[model samples]
Target: MECTGEQFCSIIMDNMVEECVMVSILEPMGVVTKKVKGTFEQIGSPQQYSLCDHHQKSLVYCHRTMELKAVTIQGGNNRRARFNLSRYSNASTTTTNQALPVVLGIDQWNLSCSKQTDSATPVLQLERCKDQLTTIGAQEKTVRFLFYKNTTGFSLTTFESAMYPGWFISTSLEPSQPIQMCQKQDARKLINFMVKH
Candidate 1:
């Protein structure tokens, strides 16, 4: 069933539901968190001298919230073509151009954009993967493009270059929706597509 904007907002407000959904969504998207695994040792005396040793595995925790800002459908199609989510803290104002991370899940294929749309109001796109030849595994997968707009004034190219030395030169693009392309694969394709389009 399709989720309406209201439903999306409700889901975001419900922390329990959001956590569960995010875990399920991120897994198939190949966003795996670092898993810490170890054992425990016990050495101690009976009464006074007792040492309790324990080993714990730390799992990466992902915290995400969604605020439904707008909903748009493709031309002549009833199916929703896009949905926008505003990611902001409680103290954040709507008018301010704040960079928020968006995770886009299109069918099975998932891509993240550092900024979805520009600083122009918060919005995101959920588009279909019409081109099956893009990637082998991506054919049957639905495409979701997460967008973020870095208003911090620091260019993504600069940051990515410093952060990931061997990475390719990052490019910029203005998608149908507001999104900041970041993923290595998506960034390359988006830049090329934007240039040609």
Candidate 2:
């Protein structure tokens, strides 16, 4: 998982680009008017994290997707090595939607999913975004996923696709298979992972 998007985040020298504090005024109609103001994001940084399988096998980028491999210190610049972990937040709009959904970033590509692939099944995808988000709440919807944290006080985590709910990010029991999106009801498949900082 080589990090290719060097321009992913511009190193900011001032607080101006990192955050903006201001006032807001709005009037929907002559009968209703209101004023509101607070802080807003102009750009957000992707915080780093590392992901591994339940067996602690590091995920490596391969064939435009992910596969299992031994954790390596030389994770980046190797092309197929696991590298460049980041938390790419999902857009927060509708109140009913999960708050701040997450899209895990492997290298620069997002850990995305599609309802159907050439095999006509849900699968994981490494999608490169054409338009980088300039705000915190703006996200690529197709890449969004919901995080399921372990309740027993472990750093373990699992991800389920936001677009197609109940489909989780999973890998085959057999080694070397590309990661796939498995149904929640599926009795087989490895979905839980160890997410580390």
Candidate 3:
């Protein structure tokens, strides 16, 4: 499942004109309330955070409807993924809600949805999958990503498709569609973003 706008809050960087998906980390005391703000272009920039000292053992979170939700990817014959909205919480308001399920859209580069249908679920076709994400109308292949945190905060650092290298993860114009991997020179600059709350 691609991390598009369906589950994530997409923010466009003013200066660089790049859009990044907002991902959060689950903290023990409560969800980390600090907001991560920075541009991927400036790798040397400092991040402002208000997180706890123990920032370990955290899970990936997706921001939806101003609330932070937990993300889970299913295993086994059914490669389904969902976000637990029941655990939804508002860091600023300090409010919690009942847990609900949001189905993930497995269209290689698209985000997940709340619909409970098979067509809504994306199928990962390894052999038929495209060699690059940028190539649309390719086979369906779900991808795993690698995130890096340098001097910057916990934003997306760098990512590669499951079977495709030299091609990195990226988003296209329509947020409803799957994100693509491009070979263009600026593709890296477009995807190597910081993930913050």
- Quick one: best TM-score, which candidate? 2
Candidate 2 Cα lDDT to native: 0.48
**Per-candidate TM-score against the hidden true structure:** 0.19, 0.55, 0.23
Residue 157 alpha-carbon offset, candidate 2, angstroms: 0.4
Give lDDT tens digits, candidate 1, residues 84-103: 22221212212223333223
Model 3 per-residue lDDT at 186: 49
Scored by CA lDDT, what does every candidate get?
Answer: 0.25, 0.48, 0.26
Point out the higher-scoring one by lDDT: 1 or 3.
Answer: 3
Off by over 4 Å in 1: 1-75, 83-97, 112-147, 150-197
Ranking by TM-score: 2, 3, 1
By summed lDDT, the worst window of 10 consecutive residues in model 3 runs over 50-59
TM-score of 2: 0.55
lDDT of model 3 at position 28: 14
Candidate 3 has a TM-score of 0.23
RMSD of 2: 21.9
lDDT of 3 by residue, 130-170 (tens): 33322122123222211111122443333322223333434
Per-residue lDDT for 40-95 in model 2, tens only?
A: 13324666656666765566666533443434334453433443433333223232
